[model samples]
Target: MQAFLQQLPALIGVVIGALASFAATSAAERSRWRRTQSVRWDERRLTAYAEYASAVKKVISLSVRIAAHRGIHPDIDALPPEEGLPALAAAEEERTVKWETVLLLGTGSTVVAARAWHESAFRLQRIASGREVELSWSEAIDAVSKARRRFYEAAKADIGIALGDVPESYDWQISRLIAADSTPPERNT
Candidate 1:
């Protein structure tokens, strides 16, 4: 009985050590799981952001081509409305579908920026469709560019990318001016 009593402290110490080890392991595993989930969510958000941007850009590209056909963007190659309108519609549909994913995965500010970007793109579409006459093509393009920059900024921040300001490109204006000096190709409707 004396021997057992003497060994009780050692047994108690062993049990306590095992419990501490288990607790530490459990905490580490939980942290790892959380980190994994965070990474997975980040990846999904990035994909959503990229897909939404691609879809929007596709719509904008189609609109620009159609606008070129209407003599609005001389720098771009004209795509007659017959050919361009259908393509633009398809691109818009794609954008709409991708937008759902963005809504599901994007952060609040990112989603707002995305919405602004797409709305600017819709303005371009309206101009190309001859539904908006008040806004100049150049102004619409500028608005889209600015909105796109904002969306990219929001997305980068959401994804923890701390890069500085996104550089603005004036290449479009330069190209437009250069093209304006020359005659545009005749667009057959």
Candidate 2:
């Protein structure tokens, strides 16, 4: 009886040690699971952001082409209204479909930014279609560009990226202009 009583403290210490180890392991596993889930969701949100941006850009591009037809962009080759309108409609439809995914996966700020971008893009479309003449092409383009920058900023922040500010780049437009100017005119034989 004395021997058993003396050994009781040792047995109790073993049980406590085992319980502590179990608790620590459980907590670590739970933390790991939570981290993995967070990463997976972040990846999904990033993909949604990218796809939505691509869709919106397609709509904007078509609108720009249509606007060029109306002599809004002197540097760009004009796409006739008959050809531009149908393609614009198709691009807008794709943007709408991509918007649903953004709504589902994006954070609040990101979703708001996405909405702003699309709304601006819609305004650009209206300008191209001659539905809204109050806003000039350059004004519409600036609005869309600003909204796009905001959306990208929100998306980057949501995904834990630390990009300070997205710089405004109109290099593509400048390059296009330069290329157009450099092209040699074809001579009639």
The Cα local distance difference test for each model comes to 0.84, 0.81
- What TM-scores do the predictions have? 0.85, 0.86
Lowest lDDT sum, 10 consecutive residues, model 1, at 170-179
RMSD of each: 3.3, 5.0
lDDT assessment of candidate 1: 0.84
Taking the tens digit of each residue's C-alpha lDDT, what string does model 2 give over 114-172?
Answer: 99999999998897787956666666777777788889889999999986642735235
Q: Report the C-alpha lDDT of model 1 over 1-189, residue by residue, as the tens digit.
A: 999999999999999999999999999999999999989999999999999999998998888878788876674577888998999999999999999999999989999999999999999999888795666776777788788888988998999988474373524653454346356456554
Number of clashes in model 1?
0
lDDT of 1 at 161: 83
Q: Report how far residue 67 has shifted in candidate 1, in Å.
A: 0.9
